[model samples]
Target: MYRTWRFATGCNDACAIDDYRDICPVFFFGGIHSKKGFFMGIVRKPSVTPPSSRSPVDATPSRTRPGSATFGDGPAVKIFRPDTDQAQVEVPRQSAAADSMITVSSMPSAQILPMHPMAGSLARYSLRAPANLPAANALGLRVFKSRNYVDIAPGEIVLVRETGTAGEYRAALVSELVALGPVLFYHPLSKTWTLERPHPLPEPGKVIDIDIDQLVRKVRKEHAQKHRVHTGNDDSFEYSAAQEGALVARGLKQFPPEQAAIIRSELQAVESIFADAGHAIGQNYKDADAVYESFFGVDHHAVAQRFADSVARGQALSSEYQGTWGDEKFVGVDADSNSAAWMYKRDFHGRFFINRKYMQRGVLSISLGHEMLHTNRIDRFQTIGPNAADYFYLDSRLGRLLNWDTLADYDVPERSVSDAIMRGGLTVEYLNAFTNDHDNFLFGVSDYLGIGDDLPLQTAVDLFNANPSLRAHLAVNNADSLVYAAKSMQTLHQSKTEYAWLDSLIDD
Candidate 1:
């Protein structure tokens, strides 16, 4: 079926489609929620497939825009084209032999209005998902990739709302982070896009008139000015790699003088491992391999071989990890979000779970940190070497993460559940810091690296690297503080949930 939509006079936007190939959400029969009132009609979600080689999924609108709707409701939405005063389009129908044939022979030409200052600018950015019906869908666009996401910081857009030569809306952004209004509406008086909450009442002509080309150029100019420093740190970053290494090397020789020493003490705290398998085999897996290979000269093959050997010797138990962190958010949107200690639990939980996703691996993975909090049998803590998290923690920095002024800090590991991740980022950083060959062997020895609960090992590795990468990316635009603040101010689990163990890993 063919359809055409025309903008009313004083408006210049125009779109018409030759083919209405049905898939989903796009060009489908659905109801639309409008400020004026709910209506059903013959409407469509249309876009030109990639001009060149991109696949259909790639061509699909990467992000949901302001007027985008699910396109599935009580009945097919009739053709709609916003006019200067009314936000409606009429479809004509004529009855014939019990079957009605509807056709509109004429479409009024959309008047060519003077272009706005921000027209054709594909300069793009992102907006946080609002608490609206379509908000969940904001995550589905290919850009999120769900886990392997880059900086969600402002200027880093996953996808742009392009003027697909078909849609009435044309929006995109470039590199520079400039004026962005997720809820932008056209200001008839100013003739420029403004960052204001769109009015609730039905005032169609006075609302947003996005120019994809304009935004594209604007963002580029803005991002160019921001990227000068290179390092994600805007305050002038100067770090001595040598100094960081020397700090760890200094403590290399220290050990508790006891049979049940720091390492053994940690091993004694064994909890069941919760290994989660993931669909991703992308940068996350590559990063883990890279981090391990660069520092310790170890790769996936070696790790796999060792796990095999450990299994052959009965030293390691293989099991699949479970759970999905997708539906999971840093903060709950419902009454749960209203909890008295919402911020603390939500913030830390997101980071903890995110880092866990970073650490995910193919084989049996565990939370080495969580297993260290509760040791059921004192006699069982003697094992070390491959397939044991204890070996990794024996002389490594991971031990530093399990600290407490009071003995209550002992329970932090046990609290590393799905809903709450405790000190997860710190744990990952400590593990990553142990990238030295000696440190790697000390911490990365276990096949079934003991993580009793929450995200599997690979997940942690992914999030661990993901954050720093994101931080660095945002440092370009000075939004690093926004990301950091969100990641920080979080508790081990809940707000009342204090760190249950010692504050330092170095035993006195």
Candidate 2:
């Protein structure tokens, strides 16, 4: 039966072969014997249990019914079936049953699992769990998942959109797990994040700190408004108007009504002269004042006031002239004491001495006016150096009364004359020639005077007759050259003349 069972079950075992061994005991009808001639009546198959069934099968009883030594223990007990070729084995049913009971008892009291520190660090950045992961593992990564992304591992940094803000914020994943609710928390002061702590946004209507770029743009816009350059065509006229307004404002504030009225009238008359003459005054005149202070080391206004007083006395004493000198004398003093005055007389000899005090107003004007007639007569004279002989002939007193028209058959273009006067180049000879007047001594002195040599007499006449447009262009170019020369002269004068004169003038 064991051999049959082995064949049916596909089991190979040494016991199965031994069942057919010739030396093995065999039972026949109830007796057993060995092939070696030993005889025994006992025959039995091992009592065994089938794995599939719980029942145990009884061994065949010994063939000898009465008295074979009953092998109760059997030859050698085996735990496995001998008929099978498989190795010996023990069943684990007892141990497995014990384990199952223990597992059931341990279940209901399970502790909460602590998260990894790495996971906590990653919670700073609002990253999501991987897509392939189960829903339970993906809980903390909702912010990243909503964006269709996955969580960054710890020690990684990511740029993320700041919550409730338009711009992005940077965050570092310092840990892999977080226990608290996942949310992006920014610390502005340290520029970091905290998994344990979070900050709240500002309340409604509260002011927040401005971004640097916004502040810069705002400041640039304000600066553009404040400092935009004036591009209107009226700029030149506007500057003149401002100067007049300044004078009027000063007069109104400082003077009584009657005095202010007189001052305003005087200013109006002077401005009329400037406008009719096409003379660039105002700013140029004030700049001259600064140069005067620098050059003479004295207040230019004080000098001008002193000069004005002298001029007033000269005009009052003289009765031959009837026309108003106006405030020309005052304005002249201020302008001439400055840089324009230097430019005007730069080519003239003894300009320093001639310009000092009120010499131009007193002696020079008187002398030049008389010489103009003589130059008109001969058409040869020039206005430079001394002209005492011509003055004697004309008699200085009557000479002042004779307007150029009476002496010569021409009218002086008043605007051109005024420009020349304001520019300081309007010599008596040039003026007489410009008006198409005749003068004998003018022709005789034209070549003798050094002025004609420095600036040729013909050239001077041409420049004098130039139209306003051409004259303005020339004036600009001349002004630049004049400034350059004046600076050079100033430097030379300081190093040589002023220093040397100071030593002699000041007490040791």
* Most TM-score-accurate candidate: 1
> Per-residue lDDT tens digits of candidate 1, residues 178-235?
1111323333333333334334444777776676667997886588468522211211
lDDT of 2 by residue, 1-508 (tens): 1100101121122122222110111111111100010111123222221112212222221122224432221222111111111111122233765876654222121112234454453433343222233221222222423221223343222323333344323242222111111334444444444443434456889957656666897886697468632222123322322321221221122334553344335334322322221111111333444333322223234333222221222222121111232111111111122111110111111111111222222223222122111111111111111111110011111222223223221122222222222232334443331112112122223322334323444455344333333222222212111122123223333344347677677756
Off by more than 4 A, model 1: 1-183, 200-508
Mind sharing the TM-score for model 2? 0.15
The local distance difference test score of each candidate is: 0.22, 0.25
Error of 2 at 508 (Å): 87
